[model samples]
Target: MTPEDRFPGPELPDSGPRHQPDLDVLPYGSYYEPEPEPGFEPEAGYGYTTTSGYGGARFLEAHWPTASQQAHPGEPVHPQAPAAEDPPTIELGPPLDKFGKPIEELNFPYPQPEPGEAPGPLYVVGDVHGYLDELLAALHQQGLIDAEGHWAAGRSRVWFLGDFTDRGPDGIGVIDLVMQLAAEAAAAGGYCRALMGNHELLFLGAAKYGDEPVQSTAGTASFLAAWRLNGGQQQDLERLQTHHISWLSRLPALALEDGHLLLHSDTTAYLEYGESITEVNDAVHHLLTEEGADEWWDCFRRFTKRFAFRGDAGPQAVHELLGAYGGQRVVHGHSPIPYLTGSTHLDDGTPPHVPGPYIYADELAIAMDGGVTMEGRLLVARLPLN
Candidate 1:
């Protein structure tokens, strides 16, 4: 299916009373014009290609669903309203070639480590915002998966940094692939796990509380509205089965492997959840399971915060998280490396080239998100970078 078909334009609503939230108090970050870098011009519709830092008025003005689109209890629906103009077609980079057959040629054979051998090489994947084909290509390139997309690295541990859905054509497809690999990996004496991302929270929230009004700092909002504003795919929503919800809800928010504190977001807001690693994971799990709509929204908002590990105080921020969580370095996937480095555009204005994971914050933080949504690479790298 086309990207437009996957993420349909917002339906226009008839003139009727709508409870619009005050954009000034969006509960998230404030709206501001991003400074132009070389070869980067702000687009008319959405300012940025990647969904890293867009929030507040820009999000509402450009892509908020109308009253009819989000039918609340006792709210009127006008089915005869004229259809709105189609939104500008989003450029999702070049199409990837399909993997026709399982790769029989194994250039890098799976390593056969002894039972007690320090668990095979640990690999970490960056944010995968849909873009299933790109994900498959990256995995295959890393020898993590075969041409058939099954786990090929025997006894190798893989941890995905979440964000399996939204923005692209096949979010559900991405989730299905990850889940399938998890099972296949376990059977092959390896393990493939994932961390919960802000998008995961947003996806689950939208599924659980569709149009239900939740209290927000701005006024009143709903999960469905926020999800759509942040590139929620209609096909993904339609294919969201109960099993998907269960799996997403159970994913831990943080993990530490090979002295790398792996997380989804770059914010220190995780400190609000708990001090210790186990405490943080348990607290997030509890919140996802036992919390109400407002609580869930609050949790989602906090995780959405980014850029904590940037600027002059960036190292201190990473230090705080490391002190609480216990890790030699922080490896995360929320803020794209291009944005983090302030070099999102090249002299020629082409998409930023992300050679590999960016190690910054005095080598205390490593950024893995290759901004695939913006025609960037889907990163799959081995840990403990040299």
Candidate 2:
């Protein structure tokens, strides 16, 4: 069956008045830890053969070619352009009010507050899907960075809802930008972090082992084939480096904050992996490090399931997830909003328009994917609903 057919559409009957949260006051949680910064031990120029082995063979080493043999011009080298000669000074400002928008008069998310208070403002970004130019422009428009491309949103928290690569050009470039922003934001007392999307695993698997055969529900399949079928771009794999693989492997698959359960997909399959957010993330991470091709393929397949919170059963399913994960609402990216509304976009990689993050499933779930590759818009908005 096609991927769309595999994941059935929401079965909820078209009845009842939809309920949406006021979001003026966000529920706070105290459980999450700071984002873990992880990277591979680089040997020579992004790709190198290693002596260590996992799964009874040289895991990543066996798949990559030597540095010189794998060179590609489209690859975005580090020290990303628009590199400012002087870094902009950052000043922690006041906390954002209930609306989740920056207090325009002060030009900050919120006024400076006492220690132990909530962070300035919380923001959620939808599926980027390797649109580096569009991603950069969106961030600039949101005041997250200045014209020279530096982290300028002091004391605000930005959570990327996943899908950093694939489809569009510069997937690796997009990752590098996010990584740089994470460090810069942290140093400035704010933070930028991301969730692990299925594309991440797909890209990693494709790069580490091109055509390794695997057992799938549809019989036999391979990561390379699956990725290419799912809009994976060639330039991304060509520029794939050891550090990128390591970073992607360590990304958490689930997160919770301000009463919203953050994840890459809107599927109930997460329950099959773990009971809690931490357990889910840990289980996925373990799979990456220890599992074989078939296992990884299965993991990727499970992640592709979506529309769990759609039909009459959606609210109940969402409630069950919240009970397990500790959140009042689910915020995710993967299934683009346009698909739900049956809306298409223009030819020039831009949506005719977007109503913004499609809040549905009786308002218990928020969808952020604007399907940039399909010419839909990229969504980035502050959290705490109002």
Candidate 3:
């Protein structure tokens, strides 16, 4: 069965009256099959093909929790059965570089920057929930990567606003690509970094604690159960490696670059961590390493909070975070643009059109998640969006 058949459009609530009449129409545009990359074949059971362009078949829409559903911090927003049974174990083969060569056989030399050289342009990517092909295409479109998917933007920085895994297919693949780009970008005097999204915490919690029960506001729950309920993929867990875990665990929860406070979720729960960016990041890292499952679960719960930067008090929330984090504005990913703008048409069987990042909070915040999971665009845009 296709993605559309397996996961039908969510029954969303009406977003008030609309002038447009309901018509039988496909939510996305024309579809075209792109040639698969060399030595990078699409894996089976991932529910995605090598096809390109926006369409229901290519983009699988996962259920996003509503505010009422996410009322309890620890409780899952959308509790549902697993999409499919546990996938059988399969060999992933040896790790390869962008050129399809074994990484161990390659010697990547670091290129030193000359004196007085300024940093390259800054770019930020929205949440890529396991959509590897879409991520690759977006990066390529922005000239960050070459045709072979290698980092080609010399000295140009890239920041991925987290949620690397879960929901869609090939979450592990997305993580692997980001990790590879980090190394390659560093070697070229540039850097590609990522933030720790709530999904990362969920994924790691599931990996480490599994079915072990944890205390929640809504009673007892397990990380694995919550993870699956929140669009966790079995193949991602199966394909996860030790290195990937370490890298993800080490990702900072917040970043301040070019006067933009980069984060995964727009919630002000970050203030609960610390007063400064360093303190907040260190606190999060400490929690993952030294804290128990309950503490970790609480941290995950807080990070999952969204829309703090909305409503009349939204500007104040942004100000609170900016006052503490020391950035002119906030850039985040967790809350999709459609939800932020209240323009989603899921209730009408239509795909939400996310043109780009949604700038809101009285122009103090920029939401980067283009709602790719809902057949929206996978956004990759330069910093200081105009």
Candidate 4:
């Protein structure tokens, strides 16, 4: 019924920094392909009449209201990413030790961050389901952390929207760094806090008690089978632990600071908690901590399952989530910008990608999920990357 109820409270163990390898980095310029924008391709499954396109890129035709409609000062325009300011390329170098291989530890581009210093610039990383290269490049662009995954600037925080595991080769490695960097950044005044992702829950079940069979909305599913299909990388299993589960389990359902609400998925199911923002959040956290049950878990599963921001009435959904969550807009990572931007091409087998950085929906929600699992872009945005 709530996040806390599912997993009782205790300070979540901090996952210290992880040493990892970087392989299959995304080739540079994939996002820069000069093809005519995929806008309004009537033939494409994502016909112009509707908005979603390949890889979750949002088409502006629908989200923008007719000229007669007045706009809110809070609206963040869906502007195109600034002309490609190509970031310097990073080459995978030899590892300093045996912790991870050279390819795994791509060349880091920075002086290690100093503790207690706030990196003037801040970046919020979207889901990084492996694809270390893309992750590195995005960081390079933002200059938040370096290729080495060390803090580039001290005192600057990086909030991950969750789903760091599964669907890729280096889920474990990603968590390791995230956990480590969380402390490293905090030590320097910047912080790295992650949210509870569904994949994280599944991984917890698989590693702690595999094949034992757990209840799933998908029905009688084993954590292992479901995890694998969802991009569970076998190697990440070795890195699972009680700490990761606890931290993830206890992570807040929604975080609001400034004017944006950060959540993993785009549904307003959280509204079930209560009418007021704090009331709903407190209720959700409370249920997750102590009152968990069969139905409680099911509620978490279902709330996490809905992806309402991508539908035709997506703007309305945005209003609902913001209304209940108490934010001007929702900044989320689960829908995979690529999938939200456009429909996936199952036959071709290409990597997922966000058409570009920064998207605004009817000036309501800011979609931060730049899909990286499929050799796509991994985005890092400030609270206002819109």
Question: What is each predicted model's overall lDDT from 0 to 1?
Answer: 0.67, 0.64, 0.69, 0.52
Error of 4 at 189 (Å): 2.0
Put down candidate 4 lDDT per residue, 1-386, tens digits, no spaces: 43223322122122332222121111121121112343435445532222443224342223222223423211223433432221111111222222432224333333454443223333567777765555655555555566666765554546787777766667767766776666555545445677655566556656755665556544565556655655667878876665555555555556664456777767666677667655655665566556634444454454444446644456777888777656677778766555455434335654443344445455566666655555445666655432
- Positional deviation of 78 in candidate 4, in angstroms? 24
Model 1 lowest lDDT segment of ten: 55-64
Residue-level lDDT for 325 in candidate 4: 56
TM-score of 1: 0.72
Ranking by lDDT: 3, 1, 2, 4
Candidate 2, superposed: residue stretches over 4 Å from native: 1-114, 345-352
lDDT score of residue 29 within candidate 2? 17
Which residue runs does candidate 4 get wrong by more than 4 Å? 1-121, 215-218, 274-300, 346-353, 358-360
Q: Report RMSD (Å) for each prediction in the order shown.
A: 17.6, 20.6, 17.6, 14.8
How well is each residue in 1-386 modelled by candidate 1, as lDDT tens digits?
53324323222222222221111113254421224435554454322443222211011111222223322211122323332321121111111122322223333333434444345556788888887878887777566777888777777778899888877778989987887777666555667888899899999999999999998766688899888877788999998886677678878888877667889998898999988877878888889889899999989888887877754566889999989877788889977666665446555657655656777666688788877776555777766422
lDDT of 2: 0.64
Which lDDT value does model 1 have at 69? 39
Clashes of 4: 43
lDDT of 4: 0.52
